[model samples]
Target: MKQNSLRATVRARLSGLHDAEARVAHVVLDQGAQLVHLSVSDVARLAGTSASTVVRSCRRLGFGGYQELKIAAAREAPPEPRDELDPLTATVRAAQEALGGLPATLSRTDLSSAAEALSGADRVLMAATGLSGAIAVDAAYRLRALGLPVDLPPDPLTAHLAAELLPQRSVCLAISHSGATRTTVETARRARAAGAKVVTITSYASSPLAEESTWVLLGGGQDLVFGMEAVASRLAHLTIVDTLSMILLGLGGGRSERAVSASAEVTADHSY
Candidate 1:
């Protein structure tokens, strides 16, 4: 097959993997085909586990050993042929599949809880880093357009400090594709510590950030072959943000409509 079944296989076996094995699996899963590039030791260091755990995790996924797993990764990452689908085509297909599967991955109960929390929150603090930072900023802007109180901290320290001050009725929206980002996870922890409801948007269901979240809005369908671990699907994250924004706007009544109109009009003055 052009696209290997390794990712699917690892995901299927995720819960059954022991803690160290799960950590190793996360490393493998997050890295995508890039897992073929790393030595067992490198993966172990990244996953914060031993090389033996990495070997065991691969074996648990039904591979004979780590080399077998790497071979599977290599097969999935062969160079594109001139007659075959291009990089863009592959990416589009993956995204289409991911979007198609989004409904199955997202929980209706969690969506309701997240929407209700944001709509009624006293404050909404957004925390993210790297590319996820941009998503948080966009979300903050949209939330503010509805006259909802939202804060987007500029950096990790500010996010940490701001999260600590979130009132009991506040909501902290944490976005991270891997869900293991240290600063983002820490920020969510601090927000929960202050009694705010933490909502996480992440691909990894069992990430540290999810552990810190009161509501986990898990989303995935992103597969950028080269950037599987480094950069996930921007469209997928934005879709989740849009979904939540729509919910808040839908439930906010006539006042929210006016706020959106006013916000648009104010911005239109600067445009043509």
Candidate 2:
């Protein structure tokens, strides 16, 4: 039978149930989420009935027992009138689903190479501009907190200039949503030309920025579809940055101790 028809059957059988069982049935129809999540005891509490009464209610409504009733009700339940999510909640839920699929988009070999280069680099120079520049600033602080020497140039022009002078074996970590940002790309190019390994986080794997880098991390952030990158892309990039930071910390020993020592010492005064 159709799901709606199945639920209708339950309601049709409701009128003949004993009074206590009818009360439990009313609670089931009124609170759909309860049918899916609440236990017999919980439903009993909500309906002001005994747990045994709740089970009998399910049997009268054509279920073998409470668990069967829950499964049948959950599978056949109609959308409740009050079922709605506000904008902020809806966005976070969408982002959560997208982030769960991130591992498939990112390449393991590329990630391993990027981590090794970052761990061994003489220093890391990160280049970005516009909104992505803010991500770079935050990422630099995170890497620095791990005891790594990281630099984020103050502007695109400065980034290009700084990239030009990076020492061999250094890493240039580029942050760009489009991967086509001219100044950011040029900075990565200059870093590569200087023999620094260029590691990139970008939304497109086919972008020019990906072409110049030793390793590229792909993040097809949803915000890119709107022609300008913002919230969704930032979260994707931040997730990647945070994962890398945790990996670096796991290597342990030198600089990781900065968490308890030098870095903490400096920031401790600002907190309270």
Candidate 3:
């Protein structure tokens, strides 16, 4: 089998690994580019672990051995010269880069399939937790304003009940950044089991939530800096939803055009 990118694969599996391996994994994930230049012993020492523990961590990450892990780490290391922008600007730039990265990640076939899914469904349900819940509400609002039947459940339990109540041809869009949100994943899984076609929006394609969905829309991973005001990942997700909404509206032809025009007219009267 072809070798996976160690950094990506291991990071995706971090939540499932044992504590020791997880600790080592977190260190590498948080500082892999810098850790690439260090030896196994050095890494173990820095992680406050042992050499044998490091080796085991590598194996747990699916590498044949420490040497192979090191090679993969080096390959994924950040380029020699880092961007010089401040953290907030850098975060924005990263989000823009991630947006550019989406075309290759999302194919024309995927977009068409998503559009078809939304257009053909009897109703649409959106559910998310935490910050992602806010995103779900935004998407639900836009779809509803476009005259598509949409429901945004206020909580996971309500979302689960709504999923169970969905008609046979309904569609559910589950938004989660990590794709490891237990409640959201379970809700999506149940939605799928109920004959609803599920679409997942997350950062990692290999995540459990992604595996359960019929279609997956991957966004950028979290923005580490920009302090508490950071919205890079959230913005990326909104962009994804915007793309989907536009595609669905386009498929609705003149009906959608007139609906949008009417909505704009209503909003125009309130503009200051």
What CA root-mean-square deviation does each model show from the true structure?
A: 7.7, 16.8, 5.6
Q: Write the per-residue lDDT of candidate 2 for residues 1-272, one digit (tens) a residue.
A: 23433333444345456788879978887765347778889899988999999998888776788887777666554543322766566566446533543664567788777887887788899989888888898989988888787888888888888888999979999998778899999999999999999999876655778889999886644332344335666777888898787777776466587663777888987898
Candidate 1 — which pairs collide? none
Off by over 4 Å in 1: 1-16, 19-83, 222-224, 229-232
Candidate 2 vs 3: which has more TM-score: 3
Model 1 TM-score, all chains together: 0.72
lDDT of 1: 0.79
- In Å, residue 56's CA in model 3 sits off its true spot by 18
Sort by TM-score, best first: what order? Answer: 1, 3, 2
lDDT of 1 by residue, 1-272 (tens): 12535664565347556888989988877787787789999999999988888888888877899998888787555334323777677666666545554664568899988999999999999989988888888899989998799889888999999988888999999998878899999999999999999999877567788889998886665445557533334566788899988898989988689889999899999997
Q: For model 3, how does the per-residue alpha-carbon lDDT over 149-228 read when each residue is reduced to its tens digit?
A: 88887788888889888898988898987787998998888888899999887766667898888988865533454442
The most accurate candidate by lDDT is 1
Report the number of clashing residue pairs per model.
0, 0, 0
